[model samples]
Target: MLRWVILAVVVVVLAAGSTLLMNLSTSPGTSWNLPVTPAKAGPMPKAVVEGELTHEFGEMGQQQTGKKSWKLTNEGDADLQIWKGTSTCMCTVAKLQKEGDKLTLKPGESTDIDIEWKTNFVTGDFHKGANIETNDPDHPTFPLFVHGKINPPVVVIPGDTIDLGAINSDEPKTVFVAVYSPDRPETKITEINTSKPDYFKTDVESMSASELESGGLKAGNKINLHVQPGFPLGTMREEIVIHTDHPLRPEIKLTVVGSVSGPISVVPDRLRMVTVKSKEGASGEVRLLVRGGKEAHFDVAQKPEKLEVSVEPIDPVGAKGRYLMKVSVPKGTAPGLIDGEILLKSDLPGVAELKVPVSFLVGAN
Candidate 1:
């Protein structure tokens, strides 16, 4: 009986060991061959703007104004919060329908965003955009495009203003501007007037077919302007007014900006004779320089039939273009203000004539 009981106990132990090995190899929690279950994903916020991406304004003028609107909706189950709306250009303005400090839209809600553009002080093809900032993860930033072509009544070739930056006074420069109507092909320029006619030489001519094509127009007139020398030394600004036959735009104004540098410059253009010398006539010397970077030859012409003047080369043997002028007043001249001028006439094209003033303050010696 004892042997049988011992044998049975060993059989039970062997069975228990087999069960432990099977549990470790084939259990779902510890088995390496089992598939992993993925975690659940939550819903996300989505921003939706329904409309045309680009708003085009065809043939707009400076006097024209219009607005464009877009529908903004939150299609997702989460909240859609708009941070701000920013305009890319000064001529464009963007805002929400109901403006406030902060803007928020609930799920399934909609709102309108209006973008207004003013066609003032602009021309040619223009493109601008308005940026929308939101809390949507998919679309953090949205761009609204605005593009158009602005056609003015009259298109000024090159530009409305003529800028002849720093130029030598001895070199006359010429520029041409064409004025034509794209809307009205038969538009004509009746008259062209310059505020300072003495400074500018104007000539009018019809634009050729090739010239009109180059300016991207069907018809136009070419205005030739020659900037003359002898403008008062310093900065100069002038206006050119054009009279056209167009009913809406009858008059157009253009500006000319430039600075003239004198080729033949006189160091003290004015001579002040203070008093007569004790022994001899009051003598003074004036210097002249040729700034044209070339050989200069001139003849001195003095005013007042009796004024005594002498011209001498600064460097008699050198290649520099410089000269000195000596003037003397008679000792017995009467006491008063005697005004005179010394004129230098040269062969240079731009600096052909130059004048220097001379005055005598005759006092008792």
Candidate 2:
């Protein structure tokens, strides 16, 4: 009986060991395979809310204010949550609609976001940016750009060039260029400058502060450019640069050309008088007499309390197109070259003025 009992105990022990081995090899929870290290996370797949977007619109006239639409879509596999969307200015606004929960995007599905910007305030080349945030782990945030251009309703009637008829150097004259725009309510003139400062001056008569505040100039609205001629004489060519809020016509160039009369040819075209003595005056003359163009005119105008200037003409009436001018500097002038302009008014419209530099030497005879 003792031997049988010992044998039975040994058998039970063997059975128990076998079952433990089987469980260790075949059980899902007991497998001896090494733990797998998780893969390195990749960059997010969020694309530009909209791919390569652009827009265009008509001028915002009083009656016909036009608008354009820009759309943004998500192309990623996961849901794209727009944390924020904003514009460069108050003229633009963006909106997104919700259909249901889950942020609603299946693989390859897309949603649209509408962007409406007021074209009334925007003219010329326009660039606006929007910021977007997403749930994409790799790229959580991105930028969306909407680019476009606008043309004002007004057309530059004289186009690029204007020729004002001639006049005497002693006389002052004004010329007008007409600007036509059908959409005048939304347009404004931003800036105006001249290429030749001494030869002419310009003013905008039609554009108002209220129009500028409202938007800018539009079509059918007329822009009157008043150009004033300066004194002295010879051939004159200059440019008027006008800047507006219009997107397509931001910068406009107007040309001014004419001729003046004088003798004493001076190379280098312009003069710079420097280092004049305090109690003495200096003189410089340029002889530019070319026949075939309009007759030349010459004059001298002085500025600052201490300086006096005179332009002495060699001929009273220039020989059709040729004449001479002598610049006279007087006593008690300041030490530096007295700076002023010799303006020559011409007989031609828009081309009526020519500017010459007048300089006086200081501390020199």
Candidate 3:
């Protein structure tokens, strides 16, 4: 009986030692108390899109669109959920070959997604991408890029829009822009004209070697926009049309925008109030300040019925050239957009009248 007892003790000790050694040999943090049968991986979704992640459409026209189709498959044992995701500007996903907004692909199942991009929005070597969202744990979102050279034939470096910024109605300013052709170096500008000849003058010059290199073209011209003095006050946006000899694009339009100010100016040039509770209504304030050591007295020349306007000196005696103009929407005003102008008459020099565009939206909270 004693020998048997000793033998049983030895066997128990050996079993304990084997378990400790097994736990030590296994990965760190692994437990020895798990179930007898090892746990197997559960069913999970997988998202896979076949082919190269990027495709180049080569050189194409500005107005033309580039399209491509991709095949997405579910190689996993579970169902896959796919939906459209955000895409870059000027790029969109066409109606899927599949019929639903969200698609379900079983094991070994596949679907096709069509993507289209507009080249006219940009020029030169352009790269745009779109995203595909899925329920796959491995790949929650997949990204694909479309590459192509946009042949605007005539390319404008640094955009065609020139913002003159804040210019005194009496001050003259000048801006220059570059226009060239990546396809042909000998492109010529036949004629250039400004919509408002009274305020703008145009001239063309041969682009320097460095300018041409920076424009990524061998030939092009630089345009000088001379903004003359005494233009109308308030916001000024003018168009300068350039007639080019390019057969594809006969003309290019440029825009010059800026605010022209007189001695008197109003802060919050445009007053806007949105989501105003119709029951309570709302109002906005505009600060009128007269520069150049001058004073201005304001009166409401004209206003819409939906609006109530009032003018008050910022400080009746201490402040000399500043006032507060308040435009309000009455409590009972209808629930819609109130788009109107508040014509103001001020005593400031050279500004016969001032128009302030006011927009208010009244809604039920």
Candidate 4:
């Protein structure tokens, strides 16, 4: 029995040692030779986007128009696929080529995405963004931006408000007001409208029906605004709304500022409400009475302020001769003056320098 046990122990030890040597020799970095293979190539290179991601137009005139192009290049070994392109605004139009539903680009090849946009709305700064989708595994999504400004539809060279300075009722004076779009080819005035129909009249240079439908007006196309100043004389105000077919300049407001030639005068040439305040952000009202002037058409403009200011037409109806104004200030307003002007627009005869003093003060919290 003892001889058998010793032989068994020796055999076990030898077997264990043999297995350990085999594993060590067969290890990856050990004596065992392994077949060599070429290194696996890194992931296919990705498509590279170049050129402008955004285009900007600053205050485009009524007839202003523009276009832009974006370039896409595939630097990878595999082909790049573009699914589709889209724009958020109707004024923007985008065009690109596609093979059926797929847009494919061969290695080292490039393509262009064209974008055209027009501002036919009112004058202001605008911002827009676009999205691009690709087959790139790493970067499947991309973004682009566009920014620009639309010039004020109507540019009153000297000022937005036409200051007729002053006028005489019996003189029958005529002021020649010129209205034109800066971007000649891109914009044209289609129609002219006034709030008060009987007080003003507009006529444009005659054009054939074909010319009117053919887009913008020709050079030297002129529109005349006829102002008939007939009244009790004081301060007169009216708004002239111009309709156009410009992408960015659809409609514009022209202000008529003037005074009638008469002895009647307003104490404050301009009334400006500086500020309004309240403890819990309350409300209030203000009343303004145009102390002096003959009968005339008068209207009030609610300016930018925390409190809502309104005007109520007084007892005498159809009074179209003087500056009889009333403004309502809201209650519970915080203590402070809101900054805003009481635009007393009129169609009197002379340069009416009427400045009305306006200030808002709130009660104790």
Tens digit of per-residue lDDT, candidate 2, span 1-365: 99999999999999999999887889787655789999856433454444444444433432223334444355665555654544464433334422222244444556564455544545577665555555766666555555556545556766678776554444566666655454443556777888755656666666455653464433323344443433445445668887877655678888877654333233335656665556666566665544345544544433334344344334555445445555656775545645666654444433344566656657744
For all candidates in order, the CA lDDT equals 0.74, 0.54, 0.80, 0.58
Off by over 4 Å in 2: 1-80, 85-112, 118-123, 138-143, 157-178, 182-255, 261-272, 275-280, 286-326, 335-337, 341-357, 361-365
**lDDT for model 1:** 0.74
Query: What's the ranking of the predictions by lDDT, best on top?
Result: 3, 1, 4, 2
User: What is the TM-score (0 to 1) of candidate 2?
Assistant: 0.44
- Clashing residue pairs found in predicted model 3: none
Please write out the lDDT profile of model 4 over residues 1-365, one tens digit for every residue. 99999999999999999999988878896653678897747646376778667776555754445666678888888888875545564434344434235568888888776556656554677766556778887778656666877765554434557777776554555554545555544456788898656656778764445644563444324456665644335455768887878655578787887775434454344444434335544333332333343444435443546544443444576543333354445566556556555544443334233333455554455
Q: Which candidate gets the maximum TM-score versus the true structure?
A: 3
Highest lDDT among the candidates is held by which one? Answer: 3
- Count of backbone collisions in candidate 2: 62
Q: Best to worst by TM-score, what's the order?
A: 3, 1, 2, 4
Q: What is the lDDT for 98 in model 1? A: 37
Candidate 4, superposed: residue stretches over 4 Å from native: 1-43, 57-66, 85-87, 90-101, 157-179, 185-235, 239-253, 257-365
Scored by lDDT, model 3 comes in at: 0.80
262-348, model 3: which lDDT tens digit per residue?
777778888988879888989899988877656777789888888889998887666777888999888978899888778787766
Cα deviation of 183 in candidate 2 (Å)?
Answer: 4.1
TM-score of each: 0.45, 0.44, 0.50, 0.42
> Clash pairs of candidate 1?
170-350
Better of 1 and 4 by lDDT: 1
